[model samples]
Target: MARRRRKSRGRKLILAVAALCLAAVYPLQEQLTDGGGDSRGAGNAAAEDVSAAASDVFRDGSTLEVHFLDVGQGDATLIRCGEAAMLIDAGNNSWGDDVRDYLEYQSIGDLDYVIGTHPDADHIGGLDVVMEAFDCGTVIMPDYEKDTQTYTDVTDVMEEKGYELTLPQVGMVYELGEAAFTIVAPNGEYGDNANDYSVGILLEHGENRFLLTGDAEEDSEADMLDNGIDLSADVLKAAHHGSRTANTEAFLERVNPEYVVISCGEGNSYGHPHAEVLNRLREMGIKVFRTDEEGTVVATSDGAGITFNVPPSESWQAGEPKG
Candidate 1:
């Protein structure tokens, strides 16, 4: 009778241990499901690994700073998050010194990412100078190349600096400190036009977003919209300096940006910031900032909201939208 009682107690202990083990595994199994209400054992390891890796990112108390340098009829934006810095374009050749000075003033020690957007002279003309002035980790550009001197100058610098040029592809994500940016345009071939092949970067800082498109026209914009890429942004860098060829009504409606930044020279021969685009922005009640009108536009974000160098009262007002 004593032996039988001992056996019963042992059985109860084993059952309790089994119950605890099962309880611990249940939550993990549910989290590792592969979506069809099925959780396979092999996927558990991968799921846990991914979760651990993501945990290291998006830590609390991170700030992002963006500087839209007034490179005069060209685009040059410097984004800095912690120790990482990214430069999108460097303006025209004539503006090389200015862009370099601005970077220096910002105390940018090195450039982690340098994006040319396209091979256009206005976009990348000063990049060679920038590369010469500072150490660059990666250089990104469109797949298409032009035979123009501007393109040659940029490539020459890349070769001289022993930097491998990366042609941006759609859906590629890059990290800048706690913030991240994704390439959302030039998904595929864009034929002959360099502007149409422009690279678009969607920068994300916590809940805030900024879209920068280097001279991308309607065709590229349409493709991005059709691909279901998130075109919505808090601030948008106007395409082609706010030309009529781009920024169609449909594109504007989809992006629905609260503010637009246009990079163009004052009294530029191209007549940028066209009346059509201005009127559309007005109708949407969106605020507009122009490099030509406001010098350099600097916006800082604390991962939740953004504050610009210039006040809202300084923003452009086109009065009314044409019927």
Candidate 2:
């Protein structure tokens, strides 16, 4: 596919450098992201995967921006600090070009890191397109595999571009300008369920931190809890698009985020941002933002404080139910 580009919108950027503090690296010459339920497999290992890295050593107080794009029912997040930019996921296959447009709109043609999160189409469907369009440094994804065309598209595009898939190991840290983020989960193994293998991370930009778990369900959450990494954060991206199967009581208690963002499409059939999850978060006194209702959400941090582009919602509104 021919790469597309928009008019040059000069963006001042500073990309990140990942420090893989790997205990065990899974170099997948083959693998995949499409998440729904928990995939059963190898759970976790000894608690030693929680080693400290660059994230613990950096705190220069530079500006960090996180954009949570509203890709209908999928997930995509863009993180930019200084001149460096990273993308977590890209909606569905049909939304690939749209994602590329969004990136171009931000004046970003080079991505330092691209994380597929898991083998879920909603999370990686557009990745192939984005990967083909931009000069991406490192591509990160869970060690999960799938035979779907969506998965093949991503790997095929990487092969075409001569890039390698860098599977994330727990405690891996990468520096982005004045910011840094650490891989926190998939600390062990999970069978075939893509959701359980979701690449979870704890991003720290000075004192402000954000926790994001692709579509990880309860099983993955349990493993993460046992991984021994600090789960507390100023912000969190609810797993499984805020499905009750995820955002477990124990997991939420551990995270204790002041704010939570749910990236599901409006009136999605899956009933994302389910009532059970929303009520739990509100009762816990956490503010919430949902792409279904907010379009796109943006958060800015200056190492000490965080501000959102729009006022957060405390609504108990739930999504459409699956018949």
Candidate 3:
């Protein structure tokens, strides 16, 4: 909810402390979780030294954090910039409480923007609980509708909370603390395919940009490319959990991301991050991270640079369908 005037463009960093994208990002949650920075005074030199070090690294007092949470074959991403926090999706219904746990763990302040990329249960199933748990700013979702209880539950909560479902329009930009994000997808309608109607967003924080297109397939991807909007990003959240149907080579070429984060279960039925997609990413020399293996992966960007909490996986592996 912390808004700021858009800074003039053109201060993009060369790469993150991150080819594995080059941003000065780190896993600051562990420290924040462990009660970072003792406020009881500098009586403890060690504590003061540690706090000073953290202060030096996070010099600007604001950082853009994107956590690709592991919600078992579902998608949930938490993006935070200083006091402003935004959530893309919150995974399945069963994971709703866990999603709250995820938010609570970070001590995330206010959620300015809470988006349900599409009405798929995996994406919005947990939203009802999340909305009930936190106070959010603008809540956006695609105009697409579904005839399911999961969807109904979300709407019920929204109605009760006096929250309105704001539909996204292409080119609309919003702010979160120091970072800014633009609505990029749902360019047009696609009949009954909710995936194509997925509301995608491109987040920009300093030199780092991340593109997250929830479950968008080839048709939607093509539309995004033709929209004349820049699709290039430092980090790409592979659509449809890296399903071959989405993440086409042509689409990947346009985005040309340095790092790719694929969120799926350990042994999901869909076999996400399929061999074909993984192969293409590997060929392109882009580093890869997976929620299935890495649990909740966090990427912290200090404006000029972006870095991931965990290193890219060394294994050339694709998710296997559960037996």
Which prediction has the highest TM-score against the true structure?
3
What digit string (tens of lDDT, one per residue) describes model 2 on residues 87-146?
A: 999887767776786676555659999999987899998898899989899899988889
Report how far off residue 70 is in candidate 2 (Å): 0.3
Alpha-carbon TM-score of each model against the true structure? 0.78, 0.81, 0.83
Worst 10 residues of 3 by lDDT: 13-22
lDDT of 1 at 287: 73
For each of the candidates, the C-alpha root-mean-square deviation to the true structure, in angstroms, is 22.3, 14.1, 10.1
Local accuracy of candidate 1 as per-residue lDDT tens digits, 1-323: 11101111111211111111112222222323422121112233343444334224421238687777766678999998888899999888766666775566445799999999998888998888888788999789988989998788778777877999898889899999889999998766778878989999999998899999889999998888887688899999999998988998998999999888888877777778788998898889887777676556666677777766453323453322233
| Poorest stretch of ten by lDDT in candidate 1 | 1-10
Write candidate 3's Cα lDDT for 1-323 as tens digits.
22112221221111111112112234544433443221212223343344345434553547787878777788999988877889999888877776775576455556799999999999998888888888888999999989999999889888988898899999999988899999999899899999999999999999899999999999999999999899999999999998998999999999999899999888899888799999999999998888777556777888777766566765768888889
Q: lDDT for model 2, on a 0 to 1 scale?
A: 0.76
Query: Which consecutive 10 residues in model 2 have the weakest lDDT in total?
Result: 12-21
Candidate 3 displacement at residue 168 in angstroms: 0.7
Model 1's lDDT to the true fold? Answer: 0.73
